[model samples]
Target: MTELDRLASDFGNAETAIALTGAGISAPSGIPTFRGDDGVWKRFDEGQFTYGRFRSDPAGFWADRLELHREMFGGEFEPNAAHDALAALARDGHLDAILTQNTDGLHRDAAFVGDDSPADGITDAADATILELHGNARRVRCTDCGNRTEAEPIFDRAADGERPPTCDCGGVYKPDVVLFGEQLPGAVIQRARSLARESDVFLAIGSSLAVEPAASLPRLAASSGATVGIVNLESTPCDGVADVVCREDVTEVLPRLRDLAASG
Candidate 1:
């Protein structure tokens, strides 16, 4: 049997299968990876995104953030083949959960891949099934009142010289994402770790598997007796430890795996 066949077998037979995705999965959807050659960091100053800067100069930080957001989500973006595959796998009960490091919301958007309306098995962001390791970009949170709301209006407020948009409670609004110097939400990370330990077949897709805490998940799954699969165009730190390593375009590989798993 081929490596993909083995992966399909495991996916089909396992009681709990999870997919851990990173920026690579979103690259095909026109969202550039931060470390890639045409990455956002290469053009923009990463220093402007730290939690320190947001607190020190909210106006300057918001201005820079608006520019950065445009650079990332400036165009008409849609979920690609890989995202559709994961969503399909989840819909068909082949994948129990998707733990994504991407804040792009592609996985959540996959629910509307074809139709404009929500699909049958939509994975709501508020649900634990689709865990966003980093916070969602579609939201903005009040720094003082902690009110979470849609980002467009907040971004518009910032654009109209609110600098850092102020909440009704007299608090500043910030993108609900984890900044460079900000810690990820404690409860979210704890739940992610728990999922990693509980998985039966873990697929590490499109991630370099280098970032801490997240990078440790594939290894944790492997050591916990789950079969680990890594699929990426480039070699990752965890490639050596992965039970199956496939160097293929994520957009192609995942859909094929989805088909195989469904058939089996």
Candidate 2:
């Protein structure tokens, strides 16, 4: 049998398969990643996304971010075949949950991919649980009162003229995403750890496996004896330990897995 066929056989028997995804998974949807040549890093320095920078120039920082998010939404980026495939796998009881390192909310959006397009099974979308490691961009939080609000109008008006908006508590309203040098929320860390602890199969999709804390999670699952698989355009640090390594376009392989699950 082919490697993919063999993977399907193994996947079919897994009790709880959990996915760890990174920016690569969202690239197909037109979201730019932070690293690599011509990435956000090359265009803007790393200091741009830090809390210290935001604190010093909150208006400028937020204005830039708001513009980017507005472009992301207006770019008309939709879920690709890979996203639909993962949703399909999740629906068939193969994937227990998807733990994503992305803050773009693509997986959350991808979970509902078939709600509009009836090609993939619509029933499985509801059963999928997306565990976002980084916080989402669709929400804004008040730094003082912790009151949260939707990011639509906040971003919309900001894109037009509202430079920096404040919350009712007189605190700056920031995107709910975890910024550089900021600690991941304790609750989110706990949830990711719990999911890794319970998984029988751990899959890493499109991540370089270099970032801290979130990068440590797949290792935690591996130490606990969970089968680890990686799919990325290039090799990663933990490549030596992965059971299955496929250096191919995620959009190409993910659809096959989804189609297999849908057929079964």
Candidate 3:
């Protein structure tokens, strides 16, 4: 059988599957991966453009990163097949959880039929419980008081026309994403660890296993005796360790898995 077919069959037999996704999964939908040739890390100077720099000059941080956020928001990107398929699997009860390293929030959006509505027939969209190891870009938080707020309310402010926004506590507001120098969210890390420990099958899709903490989740699952599968365009750090490694497009693999889950 083909690699996708094998994955589908194995996934069907598994009791609980957890998927971990990174930027490669989002690339087909127009998002860029970091550290790749055309990635953000290569394009920008990490010293001046990250959370550490923000700590030095809040104004400059707002000036540089806010515009990037606004541009991304205005871009015509949508959830690609891979993202939709993952949500479909979760909705159909094949996937126990989704652990994403992406800040794009596409996975969450795909799960919802509407903002107010739960997933169509799925029990609770919220319960599917996507743990974003990296923070989300769909919202903003104040660096000063840790206030989480809606991004829509202040999208214009993040754009060039006005002075930057501040928290209720009078500190600079920034996107909810974890910047280069910032650490991953502790709550998310805990949730991911729990899911990894409980999973029967762990699927690592579109990740190179290059980043820390997030890269460790698959290892946790594997070490805990879960069947580990990896699907990526390129070889990953975990390639030698994974039970099954498919060097293919995530868009192709995820849809097949979703289809298999539906049939089961």
Candidate 4:
């Protein structure tokens, strides 16, 4: 049998199947991966958006960040096949939890039917089935009061010449995303650890697996007796330990896995 078929068979029978997704999953949606040939860093300076820069020039940083946001999220960056497949897997009960390192809201947007969803009979997710490791870009947080709002309004204000959008409490609004030199949310990380430890099957999809803590998850699952699978375009540090490895396209891989699992 093909590796994907075997993965599907295992996933179909597994009680708790979880996946950790990375930038590669979003690449097909026209969002650039953080590394590799056409990475964002290659076009923009990573130093310009660091915590240090944000602290030194909040106004300029916000303006620059608004531009950066336009550059990143400007397009019709809809969820691609890989995303829909994961959502379908979760919807069909073949997948349990998803731990995504992407700040893009595609997973949540695709999986959960919100007020904007057009699909019929798809209810909202009652639990935290998808955990964001690096926070979401679609939200804005107040620096002073810590209240968050949708980023669109703040971006609108910024576009209308408000250099840094301020909250009602007179606090500056920052993109809710975790910038460089920022720590991942502690509460989310804790839950992710528990999920990894409890999973019967763990799939590491499209991640470089070089980043710390996140890179440790697949290993954590394996150590806890979960079968670990990895699907990525390039080889990662965890490739040596993964029970199943696929270097094919995620768009093709995830959908086939979903279909096969459902049929099984």
Residue-pair clash count for candidate 2: 0
Candidate 2 accuracy as TM-score = 0.88
Model 4, position 128, has a per-residue lDDT of: 33
Off by over 4 Å in 3: 113-127, 152-155, 161-163
Please state the error at residue 124 of candidate 4 in Å: 9.5
Q: Highest lDDT, which number?
A: 1
Query: Per-residue lDDT tens digits of candidate 3, residues 20-124?
Result: 888899889888666778886676555766877777876777777765665455577889999999887877777878888887778777886333221111123
Clashes of 4: 0
Model 2 stretches with alpha carbons more than 4 Å out: 70-74, 113-126, 262-264
TM-score of 4: 0.93
Residue 237 CA error for candidate 2 (Å)? 0.7
User: Across residues 26-94, which tens digit of lDDT does each residue of candidate 4 receive?
Assistant: 989998776788887788788889877777788888888987888888788889999999989888888
Q: Write the per-residue lDDT of candidate 1 for residues 1-264, one digit (tens) a residue.
A: 999999998999988898999999999999978887888899998988999999999999999999888788878898999999998888877888888888788888884432121211224333227777777877788898787777878888887888989899999988888888888877677877888899999999999999966799998999999999999999999998899999999999999999999999
Evaluate all candidate structures by whole-model CA lDDT and list the values in order.
Answer: 0.84, 0.75, 0.75, 0.84
Q: Could you estimate the TM-score for every candidate?
A: 0.93, 0.88, 0.88, 0.93
RMSD of each: 3.7, 4.8, 3.8, 3.9
In candidate 2, what residue range of length 10 has the lowest lDDT sum? 114-123
